[model samples]
Target chain A: MRRLLLAGPDFSLAAVDPHSTPGFDGGKKKGAAALADGGEVLSSLQEKLFAESRAGSEIAVLLVLQGMDTSGKGGIVRHVVGLVDPQGVQHHAFKAPSEEERRHSFLWRIRHQLPRPGMIGVFDRSHYEDVLIHRVRGLSPAEEIEKRYGAIRRFEAEVAASGTRVLKVMLHIGRDEQKARLAERLERKDKYWKYNPGDVDERGYWDQYQEAYQRAVERTSTPEAPWFVVPAERKWYARLAVQRLLTATLEDMQLSWPRATFDVEAEKQRLAAT
Target chain B: MRRLLLAGPDFSLAAVDPHSTPGFDGGKKKGAAALADGGEVLSSLQEKLFAESRAGSEIAVLLVLQGMDTSGKGGIVRHVVGLVDPQGVQHHAFKAPSEEERRHSFLWRIRHQLPRPGMIGVFDRSHYEDVLIHRVRGLSPAEEIEKRYGAIRRFEAEVAASGTRVLKVMLHIGRDEQKARLAERLERKDKYWKYNPGDVDERGYWDQYQEAYQRAVERTSTPEAPWFVVPAERKWYARLAVQRLLTATLEDMQLSWPRATFDVEAEKQRLAAT
Candidate 1:
């Protein structure tokens, strides 16, 4: 499933069916139950990863999630990452750049959010947002947007070389699906707080967003930090798939509970006397 | 207990008995039990603080722990902070300043670690370390050290006005307690890694360190962000007291779980239909 979902050079947004469940065979109830199971297992692995970090193993994992509004970035954070020990997880939900952040290169704020050793860092929206939003909204010049892609690639490469595994996922949702979700937000008084009227303004440029995301993915998906385009129309499948992606990546690291540095028997005896 | 531990104009280092439990009524087992209870309550409050931040409230808490080696800052982090949801807790252990950090004023690195709204930020050693160590070692001129006291007060005042509650703790341990703990570190082969040879050199300046800490506390313990002097010879007592200190400050915030701004029933319907 990881191999299939990994975005390659020719990774096309057109090929993915937003509603498809891919390798998962579960319905909603089954998918949710599976997510709970994955979360518990992931929780323990995350603890070992954290323990190993304190034990001085330099390895860590980072998950980057990006998508349009109502695509469930918040849900993913609340569910998948939420399952891990919060101590082991560092979450950054990138909002608009601050004046200080804007004064620097786009990567300045990106660097601040990188996970420390023994952490599972999640970027609710990441450096990719800079490129996607800038290009779709004509915020940055095309030359600058193009330049950012390489900069981001170089940055991720540098981080990967420093012992952080990066997993980038683009929650893929269809136009109709997004419309339904937005309409739901508008219709529901409680979700009104979650709704942004500006979201509708961006929906008008849906094609550009898809194009921007495709180009960004095509340019930045490298072996060290490849992008995953998860079909997200099925909220259950999207959540489950991300949970599975995280599990697979950590499992591949083969992190173990770190060995105690002190002598257990002698210390036990001495402490007993004390 | 909060009233007693909080330092004021006459906060005397000579007066605070390092072995005294002060306000606490319990022994080790009792202190341990209270800490567990406080931790459980604090965890819930921290979650609400975090949720309120996510819900758009601008309040946070910062707990700064400072003391000599073997003073149990690490234990407090492991035991007290370990009780809270790791996600809601942001812990920063400050070391020597880097080239960039040294370029700025002492408070520069401190600004970087202030808890975001809804975060319980614990600084294992903080900006106060600059004044404490620099003064005791004569690393900085006396005038510079004097200037820093005012600087810290101002910086903390600014954060307080911005809605961050600051609680500074000095874990006061006796000379005998320090000697015993350090000796224990050397005697246990496993604890060898924790033993630092430099600690012995610092022990030589014990009188100067006490004087420096006293001056710093007396000058900077404002009502908005007061310093607490916790007796540390009794490790369990110190831990429980600090935990209590934190819980009291948070409870004072009176932060409520924000009512849902959006219509719950309508969003539920929309989500259900989707």
Candidate 2:
């Protein structure tokens, strides 16, 4: 699974098939059960984190999700992170650069949305979008994109040092899968709002987007926060993979419930009297 | 029930008993069942607000919670808001003013945290504390505090005009109820993080705090955003009342799923081929 999902020093996106469910071999039925288990553990871990936060624990988890259009970013949010308490999760969906945002360095807005202590923050489409979309579309100069890669590495390292476990995932789906998903959206009257012509226009630059994504994964997959390329053609697999990644990342943090600070027995006596 | 929860023009803190559950005839079990029902409705309403947000509907909901320490503000967040998608809820817990915040007007930070279009914003301990605590503790001078009443009225009115419905709640509890809650916290080893010695010190000025809260409520309970005085001695009742109040506020918005915008028939053909 690590060999399949983790972007390595010599990683090549061309070597992996987007349709392949690399680590998960079970059928969709089994995948559903695994996801449920993952969801339960994830919820408990998140609760422990925020509970410890009450005692001033600065530990936090940040899930940075970056993917192509219709790669199930919203699905991951609703299916996985939705299981936890809203107070424990801070969800920030970064849209196009506002007029004021365009004036500042890219990381300025990203910095403001970084999860505070003990939060499980999901960045719907994060800093990586800048390098991916901007590079593919030439929103920024080539030199600036390169500089951003280096900046992202250093920024992520600093975040890790400050006690945030950064789990980055790229929902890798093939061109045909994207087409089917887009078409499905178009077909359903209720989903028409989600279907944008801009998405079709972007599909014309498919090769460029693929190249941009490959470069981003290779460049930013640091030891601190490596990118996971989950085969998202099967959304069940994608959601499950992301959930498992989060579960492992949080377990590694070794967060514990806060210890008591008051006189427990005497207080218990007082409460019992009441 | 309306008489119990709604603060009227002739409102007096002295007239209401903290231990009384005036409107609710239900025991804790019934209260729990009602809370579950309210939770289900609140979740659905919030989803509609966000789903329709794509079409540029700016309507949102903000629940401002105010109370003395250990007043179950945290419980409401955990129980009621916790049922909804984290993506749809934005919670801000206001603390003491930072040096930078102290430099600005008191409403500055409050304005920044107001829920964006299509989201439910929760203030755990909100700007009301400025009036409640500041007035009781003499954190600011008398004239400054008096000026704040007018400022808050103006600020909240402007927010209301901008498509947000404000539901302000004061968790009303007596001194003895607070003592028992504090004692319970002290008893539970796991709850020590929630216990603060300052809570006990603040309780020394319980009468003054009540007076300040009464004045704040009487001064700022405008027609746009009336204050709900929840008798919070019974945690279950407090939770159920809050959930119902939020349900009604959201229902009043009359939000619905957005209409389709694309050519449905043509899109259906395109999807069927894929």
Candidate 3:
């Protein structure tokens, strides 16, 4: 699933069908079952990673999620990242920059939120926003936006070098799916809190956002930190694919429990006396 | 369950059986089933609380877990706190104070990690540690330890007044149970990472620790912020009780989705055009 979804050198967002489920021959029922099974694996693997950290291992995992507003980023967090122990998971959702945040470089806040040793850090909407939104809305000048692409590449490269496995994912959803999601939010009183006038306004630049995402992926995709553009028209498939991606990455780390720091036999004898 | 577990006047730790499942009649099977059912309720209440926060509601909930070694404090974090959306949860596990942390009063670190509006904050061990372990180990002078109890009362009072509900729970496990759990950790290779020689040493002071907990509860339990001494020998019952306590507290908050900040019809029309 990781290889199939990777935004490789030949990858193009325009050619990838948002409705297609690549490399998986399963319907919703099968996908849901597989996801449930994956949860056990994910949980076990995360524990080992956390245990390893206690022994001074610097290794960690960072899952960076970039997607349009309604493309199931929150759902992935609830379902996939939620499968692990909350203690080992550091979940952060980035909104528009605050006044203090604006005073620093874009990566300043991102750096501060990076997962520490033995944690799985998740970014609901990450540094990719500076490039995606800033490009689409002209929040920064074109040259400044161009420079962010290289900056992001170097920043991610540094993160990858520091013992953190970086998995960058873009939940690719079609224009119509986003409209349907927005419509549902507006139509349901229970969901009204999620509906925003800004979301409706952003829809007018659908093409521009897509183009910006494509460019960001093309410029920043690297061997150490590749982006996976998962088709998210089917929510179940998107969730399953991301879950598999995360599980596979952790499994590749080959984590093991740290050796006992104390003498087991001696400790057992001491405990018996107590 | 909340009323039964409350540390009211005349409440004594010795009177409570660590193995008994008070206010709950069922054993593990029934307890597990009810816990699964409660997960749905917890998730729903958490979402409403999260939604209300978006509309500028200052309301929040804090769950503080204090327990002996191997009393399943981490289990409550996994089973009960894990039942909700991770995005809405803020979990912090307090360890021994660091150089910087020691420079401030005991409550300084606690105040720094307080849950913000529309979130559920959890502390594995909190300010009460000053009175519990400090009293047990003589980490501070006797008068200094006595002062923390009053400081804690005022600190929690301020937190409660700031629209955050405080649910303080001590997972009470018997000495025999702790010994059994520690022995098991020694018996399993995978559990070795959790075994500490110090845990067995702490066992020698079990009676003193109990007296300290009793005094701490008597001094600090109040109308606005109360402590609940949960019998954690039965792990299933402890998880279920904590889950229910959280759900009941959130339900009492009467959270609703924030009313739409924008004109729904107008937003729908604007959405349809794009």
Candidate 4:
């Protein structure tokens, strides 16, 4: 069964297969080309969206990116969203629980970081970690973990109802690819320190975590907050797919600048006096 | 009198050419080569600093960027700090006061955005705005503003004393260059909306603002938080200067990754069992 939909009338999986197995290497090359193309498209789209949002002052965009280590989350952000006006974009990366964050529910830290109207907020990792890390580490009981998934869906639904359009992406990288990246980091002395022994411990649960992610993606993906299982083996393809998703989402909203009553000519003349 | 200092042992204004001007034609031909060189150096330095901060586990960096309109705060941010690990970098842009913000003291919102330990926080326009905007708009009495300046200096000194290195930059663009940018924005249909008629109104007070900025730089800049009046007429030069400043500052700190006590081989073997 097809889990995600690509752009246009065609629901063909060709757009999604570029990061899958046999075509992985070729997929990487093609993904790079797609990123270049998608990057240009997204840049133009983002500018238009920014202008309309600033002008109309109605809609806001919240881009939620969740992925495992080396899953190309940062790469997607750098290439696809880098062109937007910094003043209009806010990026928050949620890390290990702070004292204040641990004192509250998992969602508290993220709530304050939501974008205001007419702005874009990108979350590098989000509340989904409550399920991902807690489940993997046994931080919560099994029943409680299941319950939180329902809570998350409802929480996200409420957010959608409140004028924010959410784009959630889960970057999926294969075990072999993850191993290769880990090895590459070890090979370079400069990056050796970035490699944590704990990550290797996590890798032991590769299959279990993959199954966990698959279940999460299937269960949590909804019309209002669909999850894009972006294959991260090919970084370029992952970025392009995310960018295309973002552009399509923004276009669907059909945002435009708000109308103002200021007189342009008179204001220009007034400014010239200064 | 020299108001800004380059970060080096042989710091001298004589090393900088006052008459040098770089054009912004949007073509990659003009200052692209120089910008690229500066970008490469900045990226390498940023990478090293990030690695070190992650290892130290307690150090933080607060990068404060302030400038007039079109002084390339966005450009410098895009180029200089663009390559750092997004997970470790937090960017905050301060805008004109929202109703809620106006209800509190000016520094209320800013204090909340300071960098957490082992992270880098970039402030586009910061507490300095209180002095700049309040003075420009006459929102506060002269004595109150003066007192705030001293308070700011002390606040920053305390932050520096507390392991957060503060680096402030004032992007200095020429009056004529600013007019050219304003003209280009007005001419382009896509950018016309960005041209608020009030920008021209503010242009009349360009000299007054310049004097105000000069005074602010002279009075507040100290050993704990030195200011760099980067020449902004040339966007590449300004970015390069900022990159150099950041690189030098990070180098002075001699940062290294924190030592971790995990056995990678054992962890790998443990993971292999799963």
- Tens-digit lDDT string for candidate 2 (B173-223): 888888888987776655677776667768778889989998999999988
Ranking by lDDT: 3, 2, 1, 4
**Residue clash pairs of candidate 3:** none
Across B1-274, the per-residue lDDT of candidate 4 in tens digits comes to: 1234443333433343432433333444445665666655555555666666667555678889998887788777766666454555678888887999989887788888888776668999999888886788787888888888888888899889888889998787777777777767655667766777667767877767766676677677788988776767767667656766776777677776444445656645554554
Q: Which pairs clash in model 1?
A: A86-B87, A87-B86, A189-B262, A189-B263, A190-B262, A190-B263
Ten residues in sequence with the least summed lDDT for candidate 4 chain A: A5-14
Q: What does candidate 3's lDDT look like per residue over B1-274, in tens digits?
A: 8899999989899999999999999889999999999999899999999999998899999999999999999999999999899999999999999999999989999999999899999999999889999999999999999888999999999999999999999999999999999999999888998888888878888999999999999999998888999999999999999998889889889888789888888888888889
lDDT of 4 by residue, A1-274 (tens): 1135322233222244435633234566776676666655555655666676667555678899987777778777766766454555678778888898889977788788888777778998898888887888888889988998898889889888988898888777767777777766655667766777667778777766765666666667788887766766767666666777787888788754434345656655554444
List residue ranges in candidate 4 displaced over 4 A: A1-27, A78-88, A96-103, A255-261, A272-274, B1-30, B83-85, B98-106, B257-260, B268-274
Please give each candidate's TM-score. Answer: 0.69, 0.88, 0.99, 0.83
Q: Rate the local accuracy (lDDT) of all candidates.
A: 0.84, 0.85, 0.93, 0.70
- Top candidate when judged by lDDT against the true structure: 3
Docking tier of model 3: it is high
Worst 10 residues of 3 chain B by lDDT: B193-202
Error of 3 at A106 (Å): 0.9
Question: In terms of TM-score, how similar is model 3 to the real structure?
Answer: 0.99
Q: Number of the top candidate by DockQ?
A: 3
Per-residue CA lDDT of candidate 1, range B1-274, in tens?
Answer: 8888889887899999999989877789988888877877887777778778877888999999999889999888866876676667788889889999999988888899889888999998999888889988877998998898898989999999999999999999987788789778756544565655567768778898899899989999999889999999999998898888888888999977666565656645544454
Candidate closer to the true structure by lDDT (higher is better), 2 or 4 = 2
Local accuracy of candidate 3 as per-residue lDDT tens digits, A31-99:
999999999989999999999998889999999999888999999999999999999999999999999
